[model samples]
Target chain A: MSRHLPIVAVTPFPAAAAHELKDAQLRANLGRATRTIRDKRARVVAEVPDWEELRERAARTKDEVLDRLPELLARFERAAAAAGASVHHAADAAAANAIVAELVRAQGADRVVKIKSMATQEIGLNEALAEAGITAIETDLAELIVQLADDTPSHILVPAIHYNRSQIREIFAARMPGFSAESDEPAVLAGAAREYLRRTFLSAEVAVCGANFAVAETGSLVIVESEGNGRMCLTLPGTLIAVVGVEKLLPRMADLGDFLRLLPRSSTGERMNPYTSVFTGVTPDDGPRRLHIVLLDNGRTKTAQDPVGRAALRCIRCSACLNVCPVYERTGGHAYGSVYPGPIGAILSPQLTGQDAGANSSLPFASTLCGACYDVCPVKIDIPEILVHLRQTGPKPAAERAAMATLSWVMRDRRRWRGALRAARTGAVPLRALTRRRGGTLRRAPWPVSAWTAHRDAPLPPPESFRDWWRRTHAE
Target chain B: MRIALLVTCLNEALFPRAGMAVVTVLERLGHTVAFPPEQTCCGQLHANTGYAAPARELERHTEAAFAGHDVIVTPSGSCAAHLRAHTELPVYELSELLVDVLGVTDVGARFPHRVTYHPTCHGLRMLRLGDRPQRLLRAVSGLELVDLPEPEQCCGFGGTFALKNPGVSGAMLADKCANAVSTGAEYLAAADNSCLAHIGGGLARRPGAPKPVHYAEILAGTGAAA
Candidate 1:
């Protein structure tokens, strides 16, 4: 069960594994963080009178972008090259990683500083770089803490959200060469990370980043962050490499007007990001003289091919949906077992990697479908809609499929529905008796029914479905 | 006005009092509340748990049941929200009908206890029936409405989810129950009976007193002393 808290294991087979999430601690952290973010999001969202209109526009714009992604990629490449930049196309994670590795090798740099990038984490870029004998230093405070402790990110905005200050002190004390455990304040923690990575920023000749928004018309990459570390990474390093999903492209540079306003308020609850960096290719001798853009397919085209599911590609990666998600609050990010977490991950991971990978198939069931995520999403991606769409695409357990098929067959005609209801009532007595000890539908049954019984008992299939009663009494 | 009461399948089967309460409130307000006998399950359980293909049939059935009604009201907020959220039905949670349609906030009922309200998942988020229940509950004289912490969080009773993932569901219910208890309230009230039933079951076996009650029972003039 302790193993279940991580949910990161490649399989969901061990049914009896005790869940390790501490109820009290998770409730406390999630309650506090979610409430704070939700309230702030509501306030900021309310400020925009045309918020719904903006959401509609964003959704339509993204749909258009997805349709033209191949052409947009070419346009972006042309514009980027015109701005004195090199663009590389990667079909998968392996190719993306290799592109970054070759860029790092070409720069002849032993170490590279990095800003917080989900693309990097998604491809396990840091681990890959380490294997290639290249050291990548994470500069974002939360990413730095996670990197130092060898821990996975538990939240999109706050990577160390699962770990409180005290837990962080322990990690730094053990892993960081010189840091005291008593420094629990945010400033103190920031200082500790800054002090450690200060040298890497100055010495490293190459840097890696992820694009929040990529403009196809101008061949521009934009990064929005609260900390100045991202700005420093883009500026200090002589060579810069950004590996972005092919779906991240926007049609025009002017479209940033809507996203620039929406991203901060939805994500950090601020009117605007503290540091908004937009650089097109290379800028002479100012920042990263040599810039490399890696356009990654990485299963995005497959996800885009889906009509209903493709709506997930419209996500701005604001993390607003996560902040308002009840399920994400309780289980944390590791439970999703993907770089993308919360409501987005539930729909995104399965489409991105095919539902069969690891526990990605289980991700759709992780959400409560409460609709808070849909309400808070700035781009108005109906996450629950896409979640159900993905569920339809994934392979269902055999027993469940069989049960549903039987139910469908029975309910297809009124006569069969009545007959089945009457038939089910005969077994009600013993079924009710069994439900008492078990709870719900859990009983000694067939393979899948037994799996349900392992946890909870099944309600007696209601002595009769409503249709049977309506017929017996109402038929005059 | 002729109002159709969609007594969700759970109401007809498990807890009829909740449905009765809605009929009582609407009748008192000078409206005829009709029960469409053909009404049954909303197929929310099937749709939410990944059997939405079968749910489409149930959806068509539900829409057929309440086709010509002037207004549709249901006692369970979660179920009502499900009807509105999942299907294109002009449905209202009982509180919304009372306040929005009937224009009755003060029902002249009295329930004296510090009651904390747990708004069900679909009610708060999907239906957007915000503070309507609290406003109605506040009008009940002597009722002290204490705020519930994280009132919007799921109580782990997601219909089949409680039965399917009992341990995870129990953990979530424990958190909700503990939060309700932390408020030091005498009763934990909510607009949805399914959630209350789930939490009420947990509290019944919790080895503690001050078990929560459904909001319908309270609004129906049955308080702690009833």
Candidate 2:
């Protein structure tokens, strides 16, 4: 709660990015974590007989949900209300944060327990709650480590992925009482965290969690997790508040079977998650007595309206896409500067937030559109298509725009391509001067060409185009 | 068969030898290769850069250029991939034609150097021609093949992206080159000249960077021609 949020005014762009890239320890930590998870996921996925079929089904189901989103939201609201749950609608990030803060105030609670949730992270909800004088304690083990260390989560499933066991031991020793760097084992760390969070779970009057899926027909909120900490957060508090994005809703309860089957297999590579929690509303003796569901729009409606970009909403957050993404493998999650990371994040964040020129703008170009994310996506969001669509909307540098405009003309006419080829062939000798000579590789260039030369060598064109040779031999 | 060589715009103006290599390989296989002069760029640069309207206009010109050809062959895998996915015509990257379409087991080409092959993103992911290029490259005589770490990762020569986000793009390219260097190969070869041009250009500038050769050039045994 109060501990989780800290305001950093500047959006993470060139400055933050350059600094992060320079840290070798962080890079090593992230690389190890992501590779281990990625390899494990691949092995587990290989065992499933109908994995491709399940992916197709999951994709189709998500597409169906997106098509009738408004209707589904209405249905969810009615069913949730009928089950004695009050639903709140948030039009933007600010609205969602304010709604959550107001709910915290209404409960008259100074501290609360929070389950790991990206939607909360996206709106900086914890920071807002802190501003309102309420403390939010992140109960998830990885999230707690991140909060305690005052660091952003680097991976979606593993928030503390950028920290190794030694790093975690150091953070715990500094931040938590009765913790020591000498006790760096997983069991020791888990024991210390369990002891710390136990008090928060019991003492906190209200609990906040994010739903993995919200069923429209039954008003059921579902959470799938490997750790049982989520279960404690959901049941221990007197009041429960769930903040979910509008795109989280699925059309029917039956659809959950495909997703539940697809998600665990694709994500953590488990046939089934260790803990599965589902609730329609506050149960008399089973869980929290008071239930509140905040259905946050936050630019989802605008994304849903896009013919090409809307498909990005189909993500189940299984993070299978992230594991296979090459870009994600190298740059890591923090480089993305969004709660969401990897391929799905590249497409989803831009649409959800309208590609703001800062961090959001850079997201669209983050990937090479390698399509690995699309291939692995259980929901088949066509991540590459949305990436291209968002790239169209994102601002381009002045020189780039002009160059692209000129290239467009060359592409639109056959004569222009031929003419350019002819020009290159005759000037190949002089063009060599444009190249910088190193031992074996070429060196840097001036402006735009320097961009390529900065990293690799520029290829030299031969003396003739294919058309010239064909005409000389075949006379076609 | 009437074969129309779609010498991709990059191959036309920047790497004509790649286009020539495609022709030489096809003709050596006993097919009459024709270059439809009216053919231009695949409009991928425009399409990828977010100028779809003009890209569509280019697409129209391309559709007209090789309208009646029985098959279209290209040295550039990315261009062939773009056409396979975006255009109505049947298109093949030169490597695909050598193996899948032409059924040629041996290319009769030789390259003695240790080489690493990059699975250009468009060919591997977009067009779904998985592992075919590597198979063809392996068939060439005297070629030592090594695995490229993260072979499918993009080299970041995403047309205007290189210019737009120069810093990130540069970082990505550095990683790509580092991976190629890690293989300790004498050369890095790929099917697409557009991506090759970008990577090759960068490798050329490295103090002791191994050269990057196009797949067509390797298959045609023209590594030293330039």
Candidate 3:
């Protein structure tokens, strides 16, 4: 929503990751939380006999939405408006922020209760609201923790995943107006958050939310959550403003059945979340008196144009990919330098902002391409494939470009390849000498290639390549 | 059947022994193996690193290298996957070639050692060589195949990923090594040597670590060779 893209990493991924690695406590918290979620997801996911088939269907459904996105969005806007809700289209993040801030001002409310929303985070909506003199209060427990500490959300589902229970207890005790300084229990923390937000929720005149899915056929917007805070925010406010990415549309309401099943299981590893709230425009004084939907297209249209990268838009923000990611487990979300982090963030962030948008270029290289994220993604988004596609199309350092060009030329012919191998074997001689004391492996390497040797030893190339061996042994 | 051994550029240059082992195992099973000298790298390095033009060129070259062979087999799963994606060649990972194509789970090899298998990311997820390597290891007499805890996790040898994200890569490799050590096996075996090179390098730095061996080397070994 801010015209400015949130400052992506000022430092590249490796540097940020290295700095984060020194946080032993953060790593421990992430390791435990992610591992538990990983196991839970695997267990429940395995229970479905037709899980793969369901994934395929989900993927196909999203692809259909993408193929007919313009039509579906038009239908959704018509239905929402016919049902008495005002629908606003935003071309970019700044436009989205301006629209939401103006809407909040129109409501004449100085404070708004917020449901946890990545779309809002992606747009820097809270900051925009602050600039407009409106206080956006986050109701989700993790969101509350991050807001109270004046810190950025790290993980998507659990924004404060970097903090253990004890750390969170300390935060609440220090920051909350009234707090017993003695408890570290998760229930205690949740209770403290509930009490802290209850006052804000009851008195809030305007509420801003993000929809998980917007049904075009039925003109309904849905939000699924574990805590009832989202429910309270949706039903209690006089004015409701839902800012959702355009990609959140489904062709029909029945499509919600598949997603509802997939989203909870994939996200929290639960059979079903505790609360699911669905609403259409202006429900006759029962809910908010007014409904406003800000349909945001901050580079989504461009992302949808990509044949391969467009599959990333199918993401339900389940965080299944993040939970199973080895790199995310190590570096945490901060290293990715985006609201969306881990495998999904690696591809989605770069595409949403354009690959050349600041340090977003570094996001694609954040993963090991382990394929775990792809396997766990409910929509079957081939995240690794998209990462590779972005890397090919994204800007590369000039030296790396030159080296790859030279290598490509050298690899096109067998004769050149053999020659390169001979040269490499010769180069290995000096490297082999450096490793002689450390057995047959080099523990450290010189500049440019030093990255490989920093963590693991490199085995020196053997004296004879198999090509040469074949020529000498069998060819003779 | 005559099989052309598409010893990937990595195997050809660094782990020629793995290539030789592939040849030895196939030949022992009454299959003729031919080394296509025209073959070089699979261009995975170029492809994965965002150099698609070179990667495509290398892909075309690979397709030409093993054009007329009855079957193309490679010991490296990552290379085979890359080539398969780019070309119509009937490229097969060594385990797939043995267990699926040749219909031989065991190659009558005997190695009396406790070994744990690490399924590389390409082999495990890309090729979905689910339990095929395990099936082959089970058939090898006198070989003890111990299960690797969290075997599906990547060793972080993502070609250039190791260099680019050395810190994260190292952390992952440490977890992998810890799991391998927990298995209490004397040897760690996998289909892809590139991963072994990465994992083995880490093991080499630590005292009393399991020796990383390629599955081809394990399958090719006879009791006498051991």
Candidate that would win on lDDT: 3
lDDT of 2 by residue, B93-180 (tens): 7767777888885878887778899888888877777777788788888999999997767787776666554565676778788888
Worst 10 residues of 1 chain A by lDDT: A1-10
| DockQ, all candidates in order | 0.24, 0.57, 0.80
For model 1, the DockQ equals: 0.24
lDDT of 1 by residue, A349-468 (tens): 778888777777777766656677888888889887787667666777888777876766555554565465566567566767666653433245666445434433333455444444
- Quick one: RMSD of model 3? 1.8
Q: Report the CAPRI category for model 1.
A: acceptable
TM-score of candidate 3 versus the correct structure, residues matched by position: 0.97
Summing lDDT over every window of 10 consecutive residues in candidate 3 chain A, give the lowest-scoring window: A1-10
Alpha carbon lDDT at A172, candidate 2: 96
Model 1, runs deviating above 4 Å: A1-9, A13-18, A22-53, A178-182, A405-476, B67-70, B85-90, B106-114, B141-144, B183-186, B207-214, B222-226
lDDT of 2 by residue, A318-429 (tens): 8888777766765677777777877787777777766663467767776666677887777777887788777777776687678777877766666775676666657666
TM-score of chain B of each: 0.92, 0.95, 0.97
B217: Cα error in model 3, Å: 0.8
lDDT agreement with native, every candidate: 0.76, 0.78, 0.88
